[model samples]
Target: MSYVFQFGPILDRWPLFLHGALLTIELAAISTFVGLAIAVVLAVSRSFGPRPVAWLIGAYVELIRNTPLLVQLYLVYFVLPKAGMRLDSNQAAALALSANLAAYATEIIRAGLEATPRGLVEAGLSLGLRKGRIIRHIILGPALRSVYPALGSQFVLQILGSSLVSAIAAEELTAVSNNIMMETFRNFEVFIVTGALYLAMVLAFRVFFAQTNRSLFRWAA
Candidate 1:
């Protein structure tokens, strides 16, 4: 027996797929920004804050890093609603993805922070710069420059992993693919197209990061 492939029906849903792809990108972008912000705070606190505060942040990092993101999503979407803190699918997805990315970003950013030269920090202080100014002008930039590649890779991973949000019915690319497959009954064709879309998205992310890196950190390179 021979098997035939029919992608015509799946291709017919291009608008649906495009919408899903856009939403996936939006979720990843928002999560990356929010997560990076949280990560910066956590990394700074753990680096210089009081022992108790550092310990608490450390525990959060460890907890998120050790657990599965799926379980975390379940807790955020299902369990939190039971506690009267209801969130829609997108909100829950954003929260879970942000927290998840924050955990990994914390360590990556912390490594960059630790790699910063002590002399630069001293120089900033000698110039009568405040702690915030020193960190912003002297430390944060270099630290982020040092870890820009890693951060970019993490962002890509987060984008790909955004598929997990489908568990909560977030209407992202994977969810749309599922719906297409069900409606068209072209499971293999739908998945092949979906996988190709994901690949294109990942490549697009890489190109974007490369351009951004050049624009933002060419001097550091």
Candidate 2:
């Protein structure tokens, strides 16, 4: 007997897949932007702040970077309850994803910040620009442009990693696929569809990031 391929069952439940795809996008978008914001702050603090602040931020970056993301997800969803703080699966997923991405983004942005030339900074100061103004107007643009490609790669990884949130019952793409597979017993078809959705999402993110890089950095040159 030969195995028969069937997609009819999977196709009938397109709505569920659509919902999962949207949820995946939502989770990735929110976490990536929030993570980037937190990463910028951490990088700036580590780069320019006092010694103690820098050390604390450094420790956080190391801790998150060294540990596994799954462990972090478990810690947020399972461990926090013992400390009297409880979060739902989706909330925990978002928190873990943001923190995870921030650790890596912090280092990427910090490298860009470090690569900034000292002469420009001095020139900005001589022109009476405030410290914050100098960073915002003079340093930030170039630094971001320098690291934008790395950041884009990280964002795509984050979007793919969102699939792991299903382990916490977050109802993301993977979780939704599991449900469909159980219902239809079309494991191959279901996973193939799920994988395609993830690929499409990653491609979309790449395009979005590319456009952003062009538009934001066009004036920097």
Per-residue C-alpha lDDT of model 2 across residues 44-149, encoded as one tens digit per residue:
8899889999999999999998998988999899988778887899999999999999999999999999899999999999999999899889888789889998
lDDT of each prediction vs. the true structure? 0.92, 0.91
TM-score each candidate.
Answer: 0.94, 0.93
- The pairs that clash in candidate 1 are none
Model 1: residue 71 alpha-carbon error in angstroms: 0.8
Single out the weakest 10-residue window by summed lDDT for candidate 1: 133-142
Error in Å for residue 160 of model 1: 0.8
**Deviation from native of the Cα of residue 159 in model 1, angstroms:** 1.2
- Off-target runs (Cα >4 Å) in candidate 2 are 127-130
**lDDT by residue for model 1 (1-221), tens:** 98799988889899999999999999999999999999999998898778999999999999999999999998899988889996899999999999999999999999999899899899889989998888778778788888888999898999899999999998799999999988999999998999999999999889988889889887766
lDDT of 1: 0.92
Candidate 2: residue 172 lDDT (0-100): 86
What lDDT would candidate 2 get against the real structure? 0.91
